[model samples]
Target: MAKSQKLLTLCIAGVALMSTTSGPTTAFANDLPANLDQASKSANQLKWVRYTDPAEGAFSMDIPVGWQIQGGMFRFGYFDVRWMMDARSLDAKTIVRIFDVNVPPYTLPTRYTGRQGQPYSRPQQFQMMVSRYLDGQSYAELYAKHRFSDSCKIMKPRTSDWVPTLPASWKDDPGGRGTQGSVSFDCDTSDGPRVATVFVRTTVYPNGLWFAAPISILSTPDRVTLAHDMVQHMIDTWEKNARWEQYQNEMTKIGLDRIQAGFQQFMQQMQAYHRERSAAMNQQVARFESQQSNQAQQVSRWGETLTGLQDVSDPMTGTQFQVFSGPKANYYVNGNGVKVNSDVSPGAGFHQLTP
Candidate 1:
């Protein structure tokens, strides 16, 4: 159960961290009205551009003018990023991000005690999941590591109804039940103290699969209200492309199949390599043992040869003598003289003899 909780936290952290990077997306609609008067009519009335991802067609979103859009891949699938203005210190920046959520294969214990030791109700369980996700340990570590903030305080999330625009075919989908909520908080950051408001919309399918879109806005205290209003406007204009979603599902299946096949092939190669390495190691050990045996025999033969030599005394001269045989020569030592006789070659010395 603890492992499952950690996995859930990690998956959520991955999603949140991935959101910080930009993703793949297209430009605004070409047919948008170019007139300045029409663009300024209202925040919602601004000229909006529609972006469609070309790879899996998994994501589509409409971005307002003066904002930048970037798209990229995530573990679950693809994500889309849209942001307005540079987030310089003392300046306000609004960033909106959308990504899919995939719960790993496991069941979270529905009934768990909270930090207060009180058992959480079903609704509270869901809320706790969201709370823990937004204030993930990874997120906090990132802020600290980069000196982005001194600390963070996640406010209690407020739950509300959130309906996502899906295709007609998806209306009766099993996990079609949807919910929306937002969490607001303040942090002391290196760039200056800033307030962040995050909005999340989640749809849980009948099969237990779920998808989430979390939009975050960061700004100075004075501009937080304006940033909040901008976030609402962006949400109001948001729409999803059903065709892209279908394309994404098909492409994802194909990609997974390829990955599985590649992994199987790699494992086979690794096993064959291991077998060859083991055989080689065994052969080397055999050679080493044979060499050691030969060395021991050589030492035994030398010992026997040395043992055969005896000390001898000549009575007439009272001279003590011993003879030793080496691989190339024999040596005779006594009180009178030291003599060396070579079986193969002889050198001139005090007492040298040739074969």
Candidate 2:
């Protein structure tokens, strides 16, 4: 199989694992101490720093002071599908990953089939598709069936119901409406069976744009409860930067404008092509008419045909010129034969000039 196909398969499998839902084991819920609510509240007392992306200024998240942050692109084929932010503690035991998913025009799929092997017909089908992919297995059963790594042996899978309670700071934030869930398990490492917990929160937008954050922590059995608490605390502090949202809206508008402009250009090209062909036919008719008509009449008809050809040729030439003018600007001619400039800045917004 191709590399891209392999990566895609793994991604699908990960999503399937995340969507799994089965009855929690009785022991799984009882293993952890009963003071989880208090622990989560206490975790908020820890010192944290908000880390924001320096390049696009797209997002920001709060993490404990000692955690290290890293950013990367998740690519499929030659296109980037998502931006990944990873924060790991100094001990490398706890890790949180936030995936910002977006598909640009170049990479957006023309059609998508659900897990049921059929095209979706309704918005609710998405939830059904996820449930179908998971196959009704509990978190523990899913992990046991699929190991985390080549050397890792997942065992003693446990699960508990986790509901995220956002802090007062996020009460009015749109992002706070994200759906959250969690699962816990144990994996055999070099030391032994180490406890691990995973927390996932997904936010789906009305436009079908969705992003998920899956935070996983590997720790000693004794620290499992603390790991769970910290995950909740982190979620409570999650915030979407307002400037980033504004930038995204601007980008969307620019994208739509480019699409509309390109379509208009295509229609203009088709009309010009037809006019050129018609002008050629009219010139042929004029040449035949010249053989049987007076010189003045033939010249007049020929001049009209030539003028029509010139009108068609001018726009075609302008279109070709725009094609070679580089990526700095998108050029289009107005009805008055004047050129308009639509310049776009990278990761910024669009600037349009009057014709």
Candidate 3:
């Protein structure tokens, strides 16, 4: 349970903290003026442009010139970027996703701190918010290109109503050639002898992974193959990408697990080191305390020795007595130090005189 929790947290944190950007989208027909319905319809034909870049570590097919790509900008880690593109004023669109083989640090620690008056003000805080919303989450987009003499249209049908009419051999492919799932749709109109429509279905994975499946339908059977082939190629590319992504994710999981184990081992080693250091310090302190105690005992013994030296002994009498002197010691009757002369030695006399 603990391991599971840790894994979940790590994955969620990674997704939540990924970087992403948003740009303006081509205005849909609903937002246009009521009086210019025909002009609005024609203008809507230009919905997507060509996107040449790869996404999620996958490459993209060539996009014809005169088209611009738009929508769904995704940034994973520090260098991975992914997005979908719609040709402007046309019913055709391309989706581009990229992932860097090698990535640097996603962001600095200071970026998340929400510091006051800093260059990256609230960066961390913003990242936290985005992560909270997007962690462990996935998303996808349905895109298309429509070439109209004067107009184009993009549609997003609700999930319950979406069912694709696929080609004959769609089921035979290893990828979900005929399989249907919860999908999003895109439709485009082109400028030709008559009206034509191209349909797209997009399936998204919650982990910020997605696949685009397109089914082309035209008024005549002759144009059907071209439409089918175009979408078939896109689907093939998406399938390749999905498989590659799966492989990458598997490898990433294995690598992260190894790293976590290493970190745990390092932590264990550090804890043991700290314990050993603490014990050594305690032993040193004990030794110092013992030395101080011994020194104190020696000082007490020296004080006792000084007290004993203050007592004076009378050699002749073999008695010990306290010695006292007033002002300065005076010479006795002789020059010898402390001489007892015959003149002062009449009888055994003791005097406490100020000499």
Candidate 4:
């Protein structure tokens, strides 16, 4: 525990020296507690209860009670599916987040058809690569910069001893390999300086396709110690519904088959377009492919945007809690976080939420 706090301290431990131009970002820390364990508990003591997935009870994880929650699954046109959830303290200072597991894939740009530094093979399912390969630290930093501040100059950036729940056979497979990386950075927020830590995993296949997911991110005030055990509890207590997984797998296969059929039809259309010398035909093909590329970005952007949830006050009590959103539905909640989403208001104790 002492070693954990050392890395996140205001000054670098054991360095004993200074140099200019050390990193790209820098921020100061506010004085908090010296003891890591006590600081974490006192600053953000939590009582966790299992929260099932709202969209489908496919999985459930422990979440701190009384905190605002907004998490669900994302399904885009049957080609891809992802799940993520976030829990934040009432003050909105401390936060924990989960990321999508099955995002799009990408390959290196060495091929002749490569553009934007990535190969065009399986263009509908593939995205342009910014690099041929990236290790855990690189991917974590990449995501942190994208989701947080662009300048994270203060980073104890290195691969961590953290282990992922991916099947062990993945590492043993000849065609693929997996890795884990973690880093802690000092962030300068509007209120004060805070420490943001990120953990990421990556898998690469023999065909050059790669998938990297920043699986978890936690941010707390600079002086407050991270609830390492709380984070561990969330991971250890994760429960997956077996029946849901089986049904999901069958549905996923059907989705993949549909995607394959769509790809074949797209190829035939492209061939027809090529056979014709008309400019309009070529324009139509360009529009179709461009839309696919945009879809990937759109899905990714939606995941990033979920981190922002508005606080809504309850009339029964003076306390405010974050509300989950749905299409054309209004949500009302009691002090305990139980909610009802409907166009009409609930009983006398409930108040309507604008968000």
Best by lDDT: 4
Cα deviation of 28, candidate 2, in Å: 34
Total backbone clashes of model 1?
A: 11
Query: What is the lDDT for 236 in model 4?
Result: 61
**TM-scores of the models, in the order given:** 0.40, 0.46, 0.32, 0.52
- In order, the Cα lDDT scores of the candidates are 0.42, 0.44, 0.34, 0.52
lDDT of candidate model 3 versus the reference: 0.34
List ranges where model 1 is wrong by over 4 Å.
1-30, 35-56, 59-243, 306-355
Q: Rank the candidates by lDDT, best first.
A: 4, 2, 1, 3
Q: How much lDDT does candidate 1 score?
A: 0.42
lDDT per residue, candidate 4, 184-296, as tens digits? 66676665566677777766655555556565544564433444455555656766667655655565456456666887999999988878757787888899899988998
lDDT by residue (tens digit), candidate 3, 93-116: 222222111111122224353343
Off by over 4 Å in 4: 1-45, 77-79, 100-104, 110-113, 117-131, 150-174, 216-218, 221-224, 259-355
Best by TM-score: 4
lDDT of 1 at 90: 17
Candidate 1 lDDT, 1-355, residue by residue in tens:
3433332333222222222123344443343433434322344455556554444343445555544444533333222111222111112244444432221211223334334323222321122232222222233233222322333443322232322343342232342455555555565555566665555544443333233445455655665554454445544544445664464444434544554567789999999999999999999999999999999978866775768643444444565655454555444333446554445324443333222
- Tens-digit per-residue lDDT, 78-153, candidate 2: 1122345555555545544443232111111224533432333322112212222121123323433333454356
